[model samples]
Target: MSLPDFDTFRAAQAARGFDEVVARSWAPDEDVATHSHPFDADALVIAGEMWLTVDGVTRHLRPGDRFAIAAGTPHEERYGADGATYWVGRAEPG
Candidate 1:
């Protein structure tokens, strides 16, 4: 799928009840050890590639790919050589 503009992405997330949207980038070949967040996340890759691991399953993600993780899920991340950039929508559980 083609990538959406930030405005469009933010609007879509808001419509889906996400409270905030932001851009995030990782350095090339970076590895983020296992961690968890306090809120749910919905994200789309905007550039480069990454490996996302949740529940011990790893997914390779490239431009235009989307992923989601539930609040408090333990996950790990590794960025491709060229690094990665993405737009993420976050929502706190009600």
Candidate 2:
């Protein structure tokens, strides 16, 4: 199924009590250094690929893939050579 457009997600987020949505584009060789959050986070890949390292386990996620990162977990990410577009969901006011 086709994913909803950004506008649709933005509208939906606007109604939530605590929501933070990010439309992220990662360039080739880019890495989001390991970090931890106090709240839950989710990510949905739109294109290309990304490698998510959570608790020492690395998971490769490509287009149309979705995953959740538990709160307070240490995690990091890397983008493929072709880069990637992804949507992030956070439990925070955006």
TM-score of each: 0.97, 0.77
| Pairs with steric clashes in candidate 1 | none
Given candidate 2, what's the lDDT at residue 45? Answer: 88
* Model 2 per-residue lDDT tens digits across residues 10-73: 6665565337888989889798998988877776788899899988899999878988877888
- Candidate 2: which pairs clash? none
lDDT of each: 0.96, 0.81
Pick the lDDT winner. 1
lDDT of 1 by residue, 1-94 (tens): 6778999999999999999999999999999999999999999999999999998899999998999999999999999999999999999976
Clash counts per candidate, in order, are: 0, 0
Error of 2 at 2 (Å): 2.2
